[model samples]
Target: MTTAPLISLTWTDHVTGRQGHLVIDRLVRGVSSGGLRMREGCTLDEVTGLARGMTMKEALHYDPRKRYIPLGGAKGGIDCDPRDPQAYGVLVRYLRAMRPYIERFWTTGEDLGLTQDIVDRAVAEAGLVSSVQAVYPLLDDEAAARRRLADAFAVEVDGIGLDELAGGCGVAESVLTALDRAGVSREGTRVAVQGFGTMGGATARFLARAGLKVVAVADVKGTIANPEGLDVEALLAARDAYGTVHRTALRAHDAELPAGAWLSADAEVLVPAAVSYAVDTANQARVTARWIVEAANMPVLPDAEDLLSARGITVLPDVVVNSATNAWWWWTLFGDIGADADEAFAHIRRSMRALVEQVLTRAERDGTSPRVAAHAVVADRLPVIAERLGWYA
Candidate 1:
């Protein structure tokens, strides 16, 4: 009853003699690309599923008929911790071993623990296009290698960093998208962000500046609330690297509540930008936000999505919000786009806004949740490519 992976990949480092697992769950229209998540728990199946999401994301974002860019969904995973002393070398060797396969069928990018530096080193050592034509005859030309390296390198330089603000921007964008769908004005919209890390904090600050009152915010340490609004700058300064705001330092400004209390905060929009699977079936009942925007990947469980949808709470899926950063990276790296920081941010904003609007409109028309509507849209796009390739006949 289960389906098979569209593209399977395996790599062994020639230098370190270490083997890495890679998988592409689904190749939309025979083209595939996605982030390379390097972590101990990352599995072939998980990466493959991520790749399947990437396939849908690419299909929804990039139109081959209009843009001339044919992207499928591909993902690579190295089963090692970046903190390991030999991590860099192992990654280099992994890239060299997978160079042929990458050139032939996939493009790689940073994800999870894999940073831009690692990607740059890997691409550089692998020589963009691999010289070993036996593995990729179609990529025999040296120009292909150069192009690949150039593309990968560009993403490294232009891609979003691990800045705290990146997550906030994504959260803010998601909230904005949801409001737009409801035709609700944000002039005095109340918002609460659960997780004070880069994503949550940044979203709070941005939302505050945009006239939305950030009534509540929480971290691993505890939650803070002020029905009027919270001073984002002071709170950010009091927070630690893990996004935990020191409880002792909070006496100057507002009311401090227990950890994870933001879930019950009275707000129009609630953003869960912290850890994965934070909102599951158990806590789904406690959440009281009118709209939930996932600033983190899969913050809500599959079953919870249905629950929230039934309760009339709009849940904007993480697949699109978190992908804006990736889109910016891809455009900057492969499209030869983004000449400056401002331009790069603008590009991200434009892409995110357009995608949010498209998905929202589609969802409204179909009278379905945005996530389901997005899948439907992707389903529709797939057939066009299938027909083009004569697979639908």
Candidate 2:
């Protein structure tokens, strides 16, 4: 196999007046973009890999939308602990120094550790234009600019709801896709979700409302399991601000399992909505669910995916899981309004359903798993973009 050439990479150490890292693994003409990830042990290679994923995602969107706008995938990372107050100034400085690059191709927003306030600070220090301002800078009123930015980022297709619904919708779609492939019905399917953050909580609520028996749910505090199913409303009320459902509060109806027992619970589907790499090689054997829907990015590593596949468990890849909502958000942000909000949502639903069906169909035809089949789909599409750009004859 031939190695891909590195496209753009730079490092800048603004806090110490030294160089820190800025990597652009691939570019798609006028459409290069990605999210900023802040974690304790993030690496340049990991960031670069994520950038490559973005490239595939954006390319997939362009073909379907037929916008012909140049778009590429890119990502940025910082290895600093977000809890440390002192690191805030350094991060701001580092971000400010990268203003020129961010202005040229990247438009960042809240990610894992980053918040809206942090994004605003970075934009101010860097003097980069906001997505709304980039299009309507002449509007003098400050309040108007803020409102426009909010609208630019708001959930237009579904109206202004909690951001958690995006995650829930992705999870719901993944579940439905996997069930369809497995010849299962979603009407009364049982599900157990681990991690009760934005994604997990929303997924639980949505699934419960969709008639899925939410037999088990867990968070940082502990796990709760009830074969007869638990009340999502009561669970939501018991959940704290951080989204952790108190085990003691739910003690009346269910037994408290081990912290990670949600994985082994009796259910047809398992949704990992927490942080990344939760289902690795160590706990792969403990996964008893027939299907695993990754609500979090890269929650299951490559090896774990292989292990589960070998055991006849269908694992839906995260690329398809999160990309639909992301595409919707990005499309709305860029002001590429569809016929209407309903029309926009329908577009997203169709794209997601098609991608899922494509992966499943290819997997069945090739006698391979969906994860492996996804790579081929991505590889085939990338070259078409390259050929269009004259990178391939």
Candidate 3:
């Protein structure tokens, strides 16, 4: 049996008849943290599961020594294709309708199908102070924290924003850590990433820079494969906001395969950084990689993961792999790190490396998957957090 969410509400848009859902899985210090995502078929159950994942993501990062503390998990999702002409209006209406929750309980930013800039613009248009204003009160100095976070977001590294690169840095570190533990050489390691959006693109860039060959990348249109390794930076430059690559940007030797071809690409590591439940029970057999590093939330289904485990393909769970982005946001806002890109990157690498090592060590000791080990880490910390601060602080 699963724990029920603290709050669940479905709001119907009066203008377009579209529906949006918000699920506050838990609240710590009277606030919950998560992101708002927009997709065509987003459901309450999906939002519920994501909200719970947020809880675990938060708890897994809890450290008494760190200045940044983890908040409870919550998530908001809308059921509408972001490309629709009416999508922007639906978003504004959703934000307007959920204003009270935004002001009091939920602290949200961008997730799938939405960008932080879009969310910020819509939030302002909807008369909200900020997308993350709900957690302002918890900060020691709200104004200073806001300024720090603003400055951090303003800083860009190698043509990409620091905010965008943080998560991918963490994801890449997890892969490298796994490879190191297994005695695999990064020089010849091949990686195939699905989705060239924020997380996937960043992961590809970092891994490529780290001496890993990004042999294949899949976007909405199809998979672009190069056995000798694709030019990651060129492909990144050709991507639109939605991450679809321009066909003209491909090299003459690049092979355009079906979008799902990324699943079976000959790579040592596979990254599913786009949609949820991408690697399900049926498609699990196509995976030939030794490591499946999840950069997106809930990309692998439970039964599929069980089968993959049986086959000895280790899955680095998303709860640990993708938690860095969320942590980076809070870390910047709470004064854990400053606005410098190098500082932020260094902090993320160290933290993620340590976290991956811990999760892998525990998994080996207990003969469990990385997901189970992550959950155990969270289980150990949640009570400590609640005991020290009280549930609502």
lDDT of 1 at 51: 72
**Which stretches in model 1 have alpha-carbon errors above 4 Å?**
1-3, 8-21, 28-31, 38-40, 64-70, 77-99, 118-171, 194-202, 216-228, 233-251, 254-259, 334-337, 386-393
lDDT tens digits, residue span 88-138, model 2: 665677677667667665655555556555667766766666522322222
Candidate 3 per-residue lDDT over residues 1-393, each given as its tens digit: 178999999999998999999999988998899999999999999999999999999988888888898999999999999999999999999999999999999999999999999999999999999998889998999999999999999998878899999999999999999999999999969999999999999999999999999999999999999999999999999999999999999999999999999999999999999999899999999999999999998999999999999999999999999999999999999999999999999999999999999999999999899999989988888889899877865
Q: What TM-score does each of the candidates earn? A: 0.74, 0.82, 0.99
RMSD, every candidate, angstroms? 5.6, 4.6, 0.9
Per-residue lDDT of 55-170 in model 1, one digit per residue for the tens? 67666666553322435666777777666778778877777767666766666666656645557666787676332222233233445544653443344222233322443565
Q: Model 3 TM-score? A: 0.99
Q: What number of clashing residue pairs does each candidate have, in the order they appear? A: 12, 11, 0
RMSD of 3: 0.9
In model 3, pairs of residues that clash are none
lDDT per model vs. reference: 0.67, 0.67, 0.94
Q: Model 2 off-target regions past 4 Å?
A: 1-22, 68-70, 116-118, 131-149, 152-163, 233-251, 254-256, 334-344, 389-393
